[model samples]
Target: MTLKDRIQEALKGALKRRQSVEVSTLRLLLSEIRYAEIAQQKPADDSKVLDVITKEAKRRRESIDAFRKGNRGDLVAQEEAELAVLMSYLPKQASREEVVTAARQAIEAVGAKGQADKGKVMAQLMPQLKGKADGKEVSDVVSELLATR
Candidate 1:
């Protein structure tokens, strides 16, 4: 099934299972998808929907960090639960080794030979890694790889 379809199925399953937390998170995700569709005046494809979901997940992670820093353990826990639900729809994250390998390949593909080529390397890598790995992590790896050359 497509990611969108999978999300809808999960929403229904959550409802049937009386999973309040999951249901709420799914509803929020669907609402975000719908809003994006409306705003863009087009239905979102699976990738677009995944982008929205990933952004929401990232927001949740940032909020969790902020809450923790502020000593709001309850809020942090809540965000963590929501993040877990959001993450269920995403593909498996790329591991550090995978990211490093990919970044090195991207640098080579783009002929990025020095620090000055950071932009070229990143431009090549971001599209390959988007939604599969965090941008910061990918950039860090790319920087490290480029620095060595």
Candidate 2:
């Protein structure tokens, strides 16, 4: 099944299992997906749906961090729960080694030989690593690689 379909199925499963937290998170995700579809005026493919999921996951992560910083343990826990739910839809994250390898390959592919080629390297790398690796991680790896040249 597609990611969207899987999410819908999980929502139904959550409802049937009386999983309130999961149900709420899934519903919010569905609403976000619908909003994106309506805003774009086109049906979202699996890749587009994954993009929405990734965006939602990022928002939850930020909320978790903010809540922790504010000493709101309850809110932090809630956000963490929501983040866990959202993360179920994402593929397993790439390992640090994998990201480094991919970034090196991307730099080579783009002929990015020095720090000045950061943008060129990043543009080529981001799409390849999207959803699979964190942006900051990828950026750090790319920067490290570029700095050595």
Candidate 3:
């Protein structure tokens, strides 16, 4: 079965189990996938499904951050619950060490000598790390590594 199919199945299961967070998250995900398909004029492949899930997960994380800053504990908790449900559909995230190692390789491949070459390194690295690591985390790691170079 495709990732979309798995998500659909999970949505059905969540509905059966009356898991509100999972049910809502899955519904939103399917809705996003449907929109993407409509926009692309074709069914989304697994990678595209993952891209949608990743985008939703990122949105949840950002919402959680904003809610925390606003001192809205209830909103933060709700966003966190949704994020957890979204995360279940994503692949295992890359560890900091893995990101660091890959960043190092990318830097070398791109001949990035220092901070000035950050963009070049990122251009080379992001595709390799796509869906496996958060872009912000990867950027931070690359900046730290470049600073020390």
Candidate 4:
């Protein structure tokens, strides 16, 4: 089955289980996927569905940070719960060590020589790490590695 199919199945399961947070999260995700499909004028493939999920997850992360900064514990908890639900659909994330190791390889492969070549290193690295790692973390790793050279 496709990723979209899996998400739909999960949504059905959540509904049956009466998992409020998960049911809502899955519904929102399906809505987002529909919007993406409308924008593209075609049904989204698995990669497109994954991109929508990733975008939604990032939004939740940002909201969680904002809520925390505002001292809104309730909002933070809600967003965290939502994020957890979204994360379940995404591929396994790369660990920090894995990110660092990939960054090193990318820097070498790109012949990146210092902070000025940060873009080059990232360009070479991100595609390999995309979906498997967070962009912010990967960028930070590349920046740190380049700075030390």
Number of the top candidate by lDDT?
A: 3
lDDT of each: 0.90, 0.90, 0.93, 0.92
Q: Which prediction has the highest TM-score against the true structure?
A: 4
Query: What TM-score would each prediction reach against the true structure?
Result: 0.91, 0.93, 0.96, 0.97
Residue 118's lDDT in candidate 2 = 93
Q: Write out the backbone clash pairs for model 2.
A: none
The Cα RMSD in angstroms, rounded to one decimal, for candidate 3 relative to the true structure is: 0.9
Candidate 3 lDDT, 24-139, residue by residue in tens: 88899999999999999999999999899989989999999999999999999999999988888888999999999999999989888899999999999999988999999999
Model 4: residues with Cα > 4 Å off, grouped in runs: none
lDDT of 4 by residue, 32-122 (tens): 9999999999999999998998899999999999999999999999999999999988899999999999999988898988999998888
Candidate 4 residue pairs that clash: none
Rank the candidate models, highest lDDT first. 3, 4, 2, 1
Clashes of 1: 0
Candidate 1 backbone collisions, by pair: none
**Candidate 1 lDDT, tens digit per residue, 66-91?**
99899999999889999999987888
